[model samples]
Target: MYLSDKVLIVEGKTDKRRIEEVLVEPVQIICTFGTMGVSKLDEILEQLDGSEIYILSDADKEGRKIRKWFKKHLSESTHIYIDPKFGEVGRCPRDYLANLLMRHGFYVDTSLIMKGKFYDERAVGDTGYIQSYSL
Candidate 1:
């Protein structure tokens, strides 16, 4: 299988699908399925060798647990957060997701960014605290 140099670790298939929709560039997104077994992690680690990794987990208890796990196993991975109000990546608006990925240096579908401009602001509730990711 082909793997892009950029890898984004998410919580589940839904999260993967959500990200795939807005990403314009190639990024190998892998799902942890809400948790990971040691063997699964080892296999993922082997596949991720020398790749630039990013973790975009949900902002909740289970997601926090997954983030902690990645922190232990993949210390070099960058972390991306969705506002707590959204709680999960799959529920986050497409425009918001596009902009967030773009700010992290990932190329996103410009149409999605423009579409986000027309999205109802109350949905995301003034999310000015977007964290920056540096390469």
Candidate 2:
């Protein structure tokens, strides 16, 4: 669920799919494919469209390398990281990841907790992952 309004630069397809699955709306995710080549970066820049870019990468060595590259090239972007205490994004629990996202005001795409409404209200505290109440 890549948002057309903003661009999310991630490490790979798995991260893209996972983020998309939990998002309430589509997001624009750019996959590095594993350390994107300098030659390919021009294309990504073209697609950026002046929107805010968010960098969410794994905590491992390669992830850091990729982050560094993006920071150097795309200096004016926000970098989001999962708390290492939980785990890497790929293996992290979905709800946990959702909470991490929610901390930043992003909400999950929800279904049928009520007849017409989607999410009810703001979830309380740091762990604000969505909760379903069957109607």
Candidate 3:
């Protein structure tokens, strides 16, 4: 998780927060905020110098365009391909992201020890607790 030399370029804040949640150590994360503006060019390039770059874009058309840009700019970098079938980057599960990060040599544990916001047996049949998944 802690990659001082490597940095992750994400699409939005939610994706950043999701990755941060599962990471065991601090890794530099950059959210492009839909599109990369001119001002961000220098900042991104700074990280690119002597550092490995990983792009984590959404599954949408806009995301693809950005991916193309990164590929054109930094072809040597690796990209974390998010399956469109699962939805966009923000909707991806923490475990999946963690697994993907692991492939890039990041130390992340996807198995969350804390129940967190997940529905428990007690929450079943409760009107307020909308069941999002089945065990």
Task: List the candidate 2 regions with Cα displacement exceeding 4 Å.
Answer: 1-3, 85-87, 110-135
| lDDT (10s digit) by residue, model 1, range 1-135 | 533588898999999999999886778888888887798799789878698899999999999988888899889889998889899999999888887887666766666754345343322325543332232
Taking the tens digit of each residue's C-alpha lDDT, what string does model 3 give over 1-135?
344777888989998988888677667888888886556756687756667788989998878987888888778888988778766777877766665666566656535422443313342236643233211
User: What TM-score does each of the candidates earn?
Assistant: 0.80, 0.74, 0.74
lDDT, residue 41, model 3: 58
Give the local distance difference test score of model 2.
0.69
Cα lDDT, model 2, residue 1: 36
Clashes of each: 0, 9, 1
> lDDT of each structure?
0.79, 0.69, 0.71
Clashing pairs in 2: 1-20, 1-26, 1-27, 2-26, 2-27, 2-28, 3-26, 3-27, 3-28
| Model 3 C-alpha lDDT versus the unseen true structure | 0.71
